[model samples]
Target: MSLALNIHSQRFQLIATAVAASLVTAGALAAYNSVSKRERRRNLSEEVLRSVSNEASVHTLPDYSVYKEDASNVRYDEELIREQLARNYAFFGEEGMAKIRGGSVVVVGCGGVGSWAAVMLVRSGISKIRLVDFDQVTLSSLNRHASATLNDVGTPKVKCLERNLKQIAKWIDVDCRAEIWRKEEGGDLLEGVDWVIDAIDNISTKVDLLKYCHDHNLKVFSSMGASAKSDPTRIQISDISHTIYDPLARSVRRRLRLLGVTSGIPVVYSTEVPGDVKLLPLPEEEFQKGPVKELGFFDDFRVRILPVIGPLPSIFGLNIATYILCELAGKPILNPLPIKNRKKLYERLLRDLLHRESKLTGETINKLPIDEDDVGMIFEDVYLGRSVIPPHLVPSRPALTRWILTQPLTPENCVVMEYADAEKHVKECSNPTIHPRDIWGEDVNALVERRSEEVARQRAPA
Candidate 1:
């Protein structure tokens, strides 16, 4: 009878333990749910309040209605979006199409390429886009710009693009920053963006943006110079390290390399070699009073006016939109050229770039006796911020090869020369903090100034 009682008591304890475990679990789960709900409420309230506040701030801007997004309630028109993207449904199916709708994109420069890209992204099911451009619509932009019209004359490009985008898809949200995209604003503009489209024509700003994106781990695609090209079929995407034919791309590449960006910046470019097309002259005001230069913008590149056709920018914009969608959908980019032949292509590019520089300096980069292809690789590595020793630097070079020459002897920099051989110079030099230029001399700046003066002499018959 005592043994029977022991068994019954054990069963009772087991049941009580299970009951206690269940009660504790229930209490913890309830607490978690309550906390989660409260946090969600706070986040939603902040979003709605921020949206409302922005609306109020920009109420005076024209076509302000297009930027409105009431985050209080997210009413997904799933049926409409899916039906509209049914053809895409054949591609991404339901899940992929949904990703496109949910993704966000930022297009800097709402001009010919960006305007078209913005509209295409919206139509392709991307519900949100941010447009940046400071320029107001002028008559000159009407030829190629997708969003510009006589009605949009004197209006900011972002505003015009936003307005036009809304006409295409009323449910989409367009954020307009009627200001030029500068490096300082990168954080806010790129925040939460899946892709950044570098439609900016200004080389300096474009390169700066590329560097910014590169550092911040943001994905960006640059549109190369579309000027004077008439063939839409020539539009192709080439990595920056492999770019050729486009002078703008090469210049930007060289500058980018100096700034420690050696990786391939994918650009929408054309392989159709440019002919000797005489550039159209710009007004004196364009050169003397250019907005970019006047504002003391980028140190390396300047803005320029270029001729563009209606078809080319449109095609370029279409290509950018396509790439962004494909990238977001986890698919391979269509027509993207690989860097497999980078050695061959880079040599040709380097030859061209060197020759271009020679026109100003009257001499080639003669330090390295290495093979041309090897030189190309060295530059490629150098630009990527890699620490590979530049074999071109010698003791004779002035400017210490700009740090490529020596270990920068002494903290004062009087002696930047590396130990020439078995290490005797270290004991010989007295003042280590002497100016490096005094030890090494150069006259290359004359050529640089010559190039600048030539550009400033805009021979336009105003």
Candidate 2:
């Protein structure tokens, strides 16, 4: 019995020794891996520093001391940047990637839309960028901002973007400007850039920036309203003149036209009509305290905030980045499918309108004052593919009808209505005793009058 016990005790001792040896081996391996990782990181840092030093003699590099622990030894890791951008290289090819890498972009307004755009542009092989913003990162910005954290609140938005962007691509050159973009100083801010992205939310500032880019003949892409928009599918890229349903676009288009810019600029806009979403109201006490203009950061800047669904602005930014990248790579989006390739629809509408006008006037009319393009603008832009009547319902059989029979069928006088509504309007207008305002209410008349003014403004000489 004593001999059996001794053998069992020896077996237990053997098992314990094996377990201890296994634990020791695991700990040693873990220590080795940790040391190796640190060594690898240190080596990479040194390599990047050396590469940057070599490139520094060719051209001046931006101050990157803040990003590195060893501020004296700043670096550019070409191999790392290349590895990071391998996918883009694959897609754009060597020649295209060369252009993309060489291109520089300036983004105004480092908010939700601008932040995401700047981030992606840097990630997509754009090595140089200028971030300009007068505002600071707010706690509220975390919802849609690409990189802002709780710690970034109250800091200049441009600085925030610059820091985060440098982390993305150590080789990237980011010019951070924490100042408002005004016409007087825009030249200094915008000079020496390949492309300018207008993401300013304030209307006046946006218009000024666009006009500056237009006058200077800079290749500029603008982002229209993303606030109060939720449907990502409805977002589209089109010429500024073709944007519709977005009040911000309409205002910008009108202002641009008055400034002698009918349409050469490209804009990203949403067709989703803001149903009932309104700007957040200010507190009653605040309104009573003083003039509302005093409440704004700057005069004429918006005091009330627009409600934003987080994802919409990011989508807008993505679209902007994608477009600019393609253009820089010499592969422009010849035709964005979202901007409906429906020339046939426009032509059919024009034909139907001409026939209807002839029938109503009892004369064989060859043409009207408007063409298919004008009809399209009236149908899609002005009327938003809905009847101009009460409730503005989308009709099953929509037709373009002359609003006032006494007046000629000009773009301003045209309106979209159901076939039945058009027939009713024609019948009512046939009687000289009845005025069109009497048939459609004063509210409708007011709306039509506003639309007419808008159309007239658009048609005015640039």
Top candidate on lDDT is 2
Per-residue lDDT of model 1, residues 1-462, tens digit only:
454435358787898889999999999999999999999999999988897789665456444342255432434366655656778878877777778888999999888888888888988889889888888888888987887889989988888888778766656888889877788866887788899999987766888899999988899999987766787676788778776545456567766887999765788887554443554455565655544331111222234454467789888899889888988877757567543654664455345434433443457664323233233322332222122123334333111112212432111111112224102222222245643233332332232233234323311111
Deviation of model 1 at 313, angstroms: 1.1
lDDT string, candidate 2, 32-119, tens digits:
9999999999999998888778876557766546456432355656775677789998899999999999999999988999999999
Shift of residue 340 alpha carbon in model 1, Å = 9.0
Q: Give the worst 10-residue stretch by lDDT in candidate 2.
A: 294-303
| TM-score of every prediction relative to native | 0.58, 0.69
lDDT of 1: 0.63
Worst 10 residues of 1 by lDDT: 408-417
The C-alpha lDDT values of all candidates are: 0.63, 0.83
| Model 2, position 27: C-alpha lDDT score | 100
